[model samples]
Target: MSTANRDLALKKIELVPGKRVRQKSKLLQYIWFNRYLYLMLAPAVIYYLIFHYAPMYGAVVAFKDFSITKGILGSDWAGFKHFEYLFSQDKFWQVIQNTIIISVYRLIFGFPAPIIVALLLNEVRARLFKRTVQTVIYLPHFISWVILGGILINLLSTDNGVINNIIKAFGGTPIGFMSDETYFRGTLVFSMIWKEFGWNTIIYMAALAGIPPQLYEAAVIDGASRWQRLLHVTIPLIRSTIILILILRLGGIMEAGFEQIFVLYHPGVYSVADIIDTYVYRIGLTEGRFSIAAAVGLFKSAINFALLVLANRLARLMGEQGVY
Candidate 1:
């Protein structure tokens, strides 16, 4: 190569490194300028680091004998022994079926409840009445499942509960709402909707608030009725938010509300109410079968992660922004 050509190539290479250096310097300057924002975010970052990421290291116990004495690292490797035992148990399959059934019931009824409530609330003309209704409905969400479970048990008691009294007044037999397998799943789905629908509406309501008023005005000018405005203007504007929430719901299909089921279900209803989370808790905490429980949990996490990715991809394909 000629000296002139070599010099030209050297200059170009020098400029590339200089450009990268300048870009990095700008990034550092931006971070320094926004130091306070990062400082505010530190607690959340530290929390996830300590609680979430740190515990992930212990997931290896799922593949080990998992002796508390031997420690996680020193535990003997057992490969897929625990997983094999998990799948071999008929009870595990029953729990899996129950989990899916409950989750599907929640998805069908509970998922749409909030949207319907939000839409109805948006249509209300009286602001004071609307706020009162919202406050009343949202109160259930703040009650812990342990307390709510006791309240439900009392309310559904066959002897002297309010519901049974009304049933007896109408010459109908009082039903075992909590104990009967036939009624247990329905009770769970409805109770979950009652507890969470109002709280979930907050997001939908915020999304509705973001819709442009001019869109509704334009629709009205074109002779659209209230229903038509909602269908065309309101629904379209909030479609992305709906899709995002649906994707998140789909991601959690394996997790069928551990606290609610654990608090409410007795052995009589276990055939219908026992889900993967509850099963894992019993096996791991109560029976000391940590390896088996860890295997089940790891499997659940894998399926959830896959579902999340698939749902996100499908959302993006449908021209909606997904939860990345």
Candidate 2:
């Protein structure tokens, strides 16, 4: 309000580093205080830089007529030729359809499962039973898809599997779940949820723990039922986390589980399960259509990048936190 005070404030503003310098200093201080944690994260950062980022340079093959001996740098550039080839194929649309359908199924069924489980677990009074149930559910997540796919094949095998045994006892024919295009995608999605929901619940459970206990106590005092408390208080508290995870999950829409699909699929179900990654593998390694495979890979990455950016923007617009 006074001239001297206004001049003093202006001088302080002039002395203050641009926003970037102050932010960098703050980040540096935080990092200094958490040096050990940063050191632990270094391996993952390096892994991504080497395996994920460095290989991005080879994306140029999407425009090149790649040759084995020529390598990426020496490959002859043929701009958009592979992309044209990809777009001309009927299987391209089929792959896109399968990818979208499977991802949508996962999002619809898999997303809310952990939240529901976490909410139920949060309300449990008995710690021993809780621990046992959590352990049982989470154990499957550690198993590789290779082993899981094998177990699925055995379970769904038409000859003498457990599911078929039940079908026979009921006077019905046993279906080859893995081989049926109609059933294969559904089976994979459900199995993925079964194997993953428990591990995913760990994050939701941790978020649930951070919600203030006083809210639940207040809800009880207000004569709210258990379900009412969960719906009104618990869900609201963890809504941001749910939104964040949903955005991140949607960003991977182009990437249906490669390992699971590859192992579970046969020629019979290839129409439904042949996703971008497996297609790339067949072309690049098996067929030696290196440039075409690289093109497909690049296309997949572009779509994923677009989705990530769009989701991040939508998340911000909706007042939710994003991975950025």
Q: Which candidate is the best by TM-score?
A: 1
Q: If scored against the real structure, what TM-score would every candidate get?
A: 0.97, 0.90
Clashing pairs in 2: none
- Candidate 1: lDDT over CA atoms? 0.94
Q: How high a TM-score does candidate 2 get? A: 0.90
**lDDT tens digits, residues 168-197, model 1?**
999999998887899999999999998999
Which 10 consecutive positions of candidate 1 have the poorest summed lDDT? Answer: 156-165
Per-residue lDDT tens digits for candidate 2, residues 241-313, read: 9988988898899988888888888778878888888888898999999888988888887888899999989
